[model samples]
Target: MNKVVLVTGANSGIGLALCERLLSDDAEGLQLCLACRNMQRAHAARSALLASHPSAQVALLQMDTSSISSVIAASQEVKLRYNRVDYLYLNAGIMPNPHFDMKAFFKGLFSSNIITMFATGEGILTQKDCLTHDGLQSVFATNLFGHFLLIRELEPVLCYAGRTSQLVWTSSSNAHRSAFNVEDIQHQRGTQPYSSSKYACDLLSLALNTHYNKQGLSSSVICPGFVMTSLTYSILPSFPAFLWTLLMPLFWLIRIFTNTFTLTPYNGTEALFWLFKQKPESLDPQAKYHSLTSGLGNNYTEPRKMDVDLATSEALYEKLLQLENDVRKKLKEKQKESQHVMHHGSFA
Candidate 1:
């Protein structure tokens, strides 16, 4: 039987690159589905993949991870379309209104923390986060909660008795424990929602492994390092695209100090693609795999122990479950209210 692989945010960047890589590797053995908010881009992605391998089984599912209703509806669509999910790549994420700290960046440049700053982007970056229609933090909703709901919704397909399903998240080296607060799991009060959400992904992966491993479902997270994709372009909206190309030499120089500058989507997807070929049962729950690029431009995947604790991860899992219940209840109430309005208006 052919393995079914579903990837969220597979329209562009590392997500799209991974799709291409997978098809190039096994167009016949793998069935690919692109779950994206923009069906237009999804179609383009499908066309691009088919341009290479016309026989490749590529499907598309419209999903908006930031919306609770959209995620649930998409998950239902997925369950109806596919019997089993072999690999689920949770690559949908957003980092909006990023403000680069030039002062801290220059200070770190002359200080001893330059390499650390470059690798993790800890002190130099922050993003303004908004709330979704569900009243959850947008970054948290798009990057973590939506994926959580999808996993829960697809538990049947994911936990098929004999076959193991792998969940690979596109996490980040920028995921900082300092940005995350247990009390504020949604990071509503934080300026670094992107970091907080990625950190949550790390914790959630471990927690998921604990709960789902016995049922043949495994979850892992990967840091794509610092890839210059459309998301990166959003960081410096003032900078022209050509200016980024002009800085390629400087980016290469930085790669000598830290291998985190994987640069391109293809290079950044090394860890994600590597995880696809691995047996999920063999993966370490406490580790976050990273995509690394050497000075000579060779790409490799490295597994690094994450700074997450089981106690915290489990606590987070519990909070997410509670939030899920609350959201579903509110949704049901809203649906009833809408139906009441429609029924009353019919008589009017």
Candidate 2:
């Protein structure tokens, strides 16, 4: 039997790199599905992957992780196309209007926390988040809730009696417990919605393991470290792309102190690809695997224990379920309104 793998946000960056790696690893018996919002980019990604591995099975599914309806429709499409999902990579995420604190970076450089700041990007970075059409925080919706809903929707294909399925999330080192609040799960009042959302991914993975492990489904989260993708380049938008190239030497210097600077998307996907080859049952649920690059440019995966507890994880799982129910109600109402508008418009 052929293994089926579906990856969200697989058009570019680490997601795309992971796809390439998967094909390179097993081009014969693997069916790859690239789930992306942009059909154009998805086509390009499929073409590029085929260019290298012409015999590889690569398909595309259109999905916008920020939209509830889009996720639902895409899930239906997925179930229609594939009976079983061997691997699901929840890699879609967004960090909007990022603001880098150069002053804090400099301060941390002089302080004893320089290594931590560089590794985690905790003290020197923030993002301005907005509300989605569903009235949820855009960062939270794109990064956490959307993926959670996708998992819930695909439970039938993911959970089987004898077959095991794996879920690998593209989490971040910036996922801090301090940024997350159990009361405001959406981070509506916080400036660090990106961090909060990633932290939520960590907790949700644990919850998923607890709930679905008995059903032959396993979930794990990974931090790609600080890869210089378009997402990272957006942080310093004013700086030209060439300027980032000029700073490569500095990044290498920092890599000596902090191995989190994986730099390229391929290197950043080390842990994701590593997880693909592992038995899900043997993986650690309480750990967040990290993709690390050394000063000499060697890449490896490291498992680090996350700062989460079972109580918090279970509480977050319940909160997400409640939010999912609320969103379903809202979507049903919107669909009915659309049908009603069409019914009245037909008479006109």
Candidate 3:
């Protein structure tokens, strides 16, 4: 009866690294549920992990954080498979339309690329997704709202384990001071929607902590300092990413000066991996954990100013409650009508 931990985006990047760290810990004996969008990648990741820790119990469920229906289905699967959920790492995120200013990039190079990227998550200038089926900006939906919906759907299982259960959100240091306009939460007016979405997650995570901690759900936010992941790889053309890989070692030198520069997925997940070893009450509700990589590739933690207004967070929580209720009601009505029609057809 090992504690169940569900990590979204567990197929690659920091999510995958964190999964390995958790399973390798002989003391915890965590039963990992790798919630990933691509089943093939999930299976491959599981196979790779199994080669090392044969005794590890890892399950895969297809979860696209961008889709509300997918989140619901994945949560239902989790409910069916597990009796209790001890940890929910909401790590699936997207940086859509990361247009980088080449002139600014070159100018900042002499100073600190780590600090420059920390303020603006431009990893070597890449194009972003322009379309999403949800009719909203893809980044906002996938990075923030989708994870929010998954947490809402899994509230039953998450809260079943009591007050100790944790919700760790993978927020970012690039969550800029002015990235999010509370009125335009979708960031339709902005180019840096990814930063805005991460900012929204910070706000939402704080909201969850303030309102739900008493209800047995504790929420925290962590940043995986710029990591070389598939997400980043997709941002740029093949040539530039390849070129950047050559200069990655130099980035580590810059990382020491600026604490938020983690180059690898393993280093990026330090904050998240450390949280698994901590008690909920021991964490600071307002402080966001920053994962850092030293010049020598050693991992370290730092605290960042999580610009969270509790009053606004509470309002967002109330709004989410109304939205959740509306969605549940519509779903229930459809289900009841379907059942009635089926019953009549069977008898007639």
TM-score of each: 0.97, 0.97, 0.88
For candidate 3, lDDT tens digit of each residue in 29-90? 78889999999999999998888888888889999988767888888998999878999999
Q: Write the per-residue lDDT of candidate 1 for residues 106-205, one digit (tens) a residue.
A: 7987898877787677888998888788999899999999999999999999999788999999999889999999999999888899999999999999
Ten contiguous residues minimizing lDDT sum, candidate 3: 118-127
Evaluated at residue 132, the lDDT of candidate 3 is 62
Evaluated against the true structure, the overall lDDT of model 2 is 0.93
Flag clash pairs in model 1: none
Per-candidate Cα RMSD to the true structure, in Å, reads: 1.3, 1.4, 3.2
- Which is the better candidate, 1 or 3, if ranked by TM-score? 1
lDDT of 2 by residue, 1-348 (tens): 999999999999999999999999999989999999999999999999999999999999999999999999999999999898999999999999989998997788779887778667888888898888889889999999999999999998999668999999999989999999999999988889989999999999999999999999999999998888888878888977787788778778888878889989999999999999999878999999999999889999999999999999999999999999999998989889999999999999
Better lDDT candidate (1, 3): 1
**Candidate 2 residue runs with Cα over 4 Å from true position:** 109-112
Q: What is the C-alpha lDDT of each candidate?
A: 0.93, 0.93, 0.80
